[model samples]
Target: MNLYPFRCSLALMAMVGAVISCSKQTTDPMEMTSLPGDTVLNVNYESGTLSSGVTGISSTHASAVDANYMVQPGAKGSYAIAHKVVYGDTAYYSDGAYRSESDAVALPAARFAPGDERRYEFSVLLKDWTPWLSGAIHETNIFQLKVSGNSTTGSGVPLQVRVARNALRLRYADNIRVYNFLADVRPYINQWIHFRIDAKWTLDATGYIRTYMKLPGHSFTIVDEKTNYATFAGNPAVGNIGYIKWGIYGIQEGLTRIAYHDDIRIIRLN
Candidate 1:
């Protein structure tokens, strides 16, 4: 009996299967689920790479995940993640938009739901942020809680943090301004700015959103707050999953914008 040849063929087939499986895991862009009882995600970039809490990276440029998105030393600590976007960078575009951004996709547990109260805390350092040319109104979103999965159900961008026209503004949906956190951002350039957003996702009047910010030699203070209002989307049957994105995303303003993020923590407090 010649069983050696059969065993060799089986080994080759197993090796090929393993290779394909490993490739798929690394190449997949979507992570659909999270570990049970997991309610916290902390990324400090001290490990020199994205943590498992981050499912994947989304960007309009192919090289963005490799080149523009980097782990470096800066931002409130010895290590942080840098997000860089250049003007007219259109290497890869399939994110349903015409923009250059390097966004880290959060886990499914990070999503918001009714009765879900979450606290988002992160530190940002704007490296080269300047007012738009001639004070033009161009959107430069630094953080967003956008609808994922089924985009047709809920609001496109439920919440976002934008730096435009030399100020930082908090917005809901398309253009609803929740608050103007910073009236002037030029003074904070190249300086660390810490933010804490506490949101209680609800459809009725019980929902509330409280935002706090801090700078060097300062303590956290409430920048703005919305209480007794609907924090989540209006649709009760919304099928979309809410996820978090922290990075630079928006229209190009003929200038390279760079920002550093560190100590990003999301705690589900429901």
Candidate 2:
């Protein structure tokens, strides 16, 4: 009856088996899915780094730039990008964080053109924003469809999604003039908002710009819809190459703002 030796042998085998199981465990990184066919650009900032498609452009002032723009954890395992702009920033064009499909000299085929339909969608949560000034316009461009042009002459930016007086507004460039397309977004302030823009760029009478908004626990609502909207008339010299920019661009001094963006995507529908 040598049961002690038998028990010792059994215990040794169990320890060896546990060690083998532990050695087989892996710590490989998970693979991310590629953007869909229609999607020209998609960024959730889950990679903890800015994609090559995104670029941070700012003026000379160091305090107004978004030098720390990076991925941050969001709700339910999701992620988002954070952008901050400080007050009393003298930089004319501060924090021009943007994303484009390509940097080619010529306009990419994926970009929207005449008769081409496209959509831009994103989720924005305003963490902090300065109080709106009465009678005076304190605007900040949070999103824009910008065209390349001469900065000295000051001619560019065909479409702009601006936040002013705690309201979302759409500005489009005309012949030496900028007109407001929509100005009824004051209700969506201080909350997470889903914004969607549908545009058909045309030089003739068929062009149109449509915007949609969705608050939490509700479906998308059409905020603005316009037909025969001419966005490129003012800046004829503006290049065909266009891109999308999103971040806090302070128009006036002594105002600080912070926002979080998630699920930004651009799709070619035509």
Candidate 3:
């Protein structure tokens, strides 16, 4: 007479009411508000693993070397967006494979873990892209943030790269860029497209970071070119969320592309 611990205590009370309704959602954390993007902790491409922030891009400043591109979750709310091919790493197609239209490259796995609260949330389904000749289809969504000093290249650290891509913009080049507020939806290529990015720290006084991007179907553009970015934290180095990576970017080295990501959720916005 045990009902499997009463269905595991009602699935842990529906995952604690979906994380207290996603921390009491105030709306527009990046949109999609029904949660359950597949559970396990949610991260796309089939839960390779991602919690809330920190993926690719890094710099302790010694000629900067940072990397985080993670996606490993499939089956539950739809993930296996394909690209594990025969299993894992296989780089060498800056634009060579997919001869008929070959494009499938992914990245995201940054977590330096020190100060915490680096924010996360990215989604895809622009139909897995493929139009790179110039009309522009190098298709992107990689919030590559790396600021090893850009207050005029003093050498490094003093980081602050925040991107929302729907309402704000900032950039300070040790490395800082957020993208895609619909520069090319390609007629909703594969349909499911949603993106949510959240970051904390606000007073709007001295140091700045107010980047935003959101394309509610033709009507959102914050620029820098690759897409959207707003980064600049003049001088308080040594904090970490440390490089948040997303996927796909064969930008200027020859291009054919792929796109089809699902409900990627990483949260923490203030």
Top candidate by lDDT: 1
Ranking by TM-score: 1, 2, 3
Badly placed stretches (over 4 Å) of model 2 are 1-36, 52-68, 75-77, 89-110, 133-135, 151-155, 175-190, 232-238
Q: Is candidate 1 or candidate 3 better by lDDT?
A: 1
Cα miss at 137, model 1 (Å)? 1.2
Per-residue lDDT of 1-270 in model 1, one digit per residue for the tens? 989999999999999999998777644312112235644776676666644235554433435553245555656556776767666765422365434444545355556777888878788888867655565667788887766544456456668888877889889865556567788888889888988888888878898877788877787778887788777764547565566777677655467777777887777655
lDDT of 2 by residue, 46-121 (tens): 6655442344322122343463365456421356666666654443233352211112123254345456677777
Question: Which pairs of residues have clashing backbones in candidate 1?
Answer: none
Which structure is stronger by TM-score: 1 or 2? Answer: 1
**Ten contiguous residues minimizing lDDT sum, candidate 2:** 26-35
From the highest lDDT down, the ranking of the candidates is 1, 2, 3
Clashes of each: 0, 0, 42
Off by over 4 Å in 3: 1-76, 79-118, 122-141, 144-198, 202-254, 266-270
lDDT against the true structure, each candidate:
0.68, 0.59, 0.35
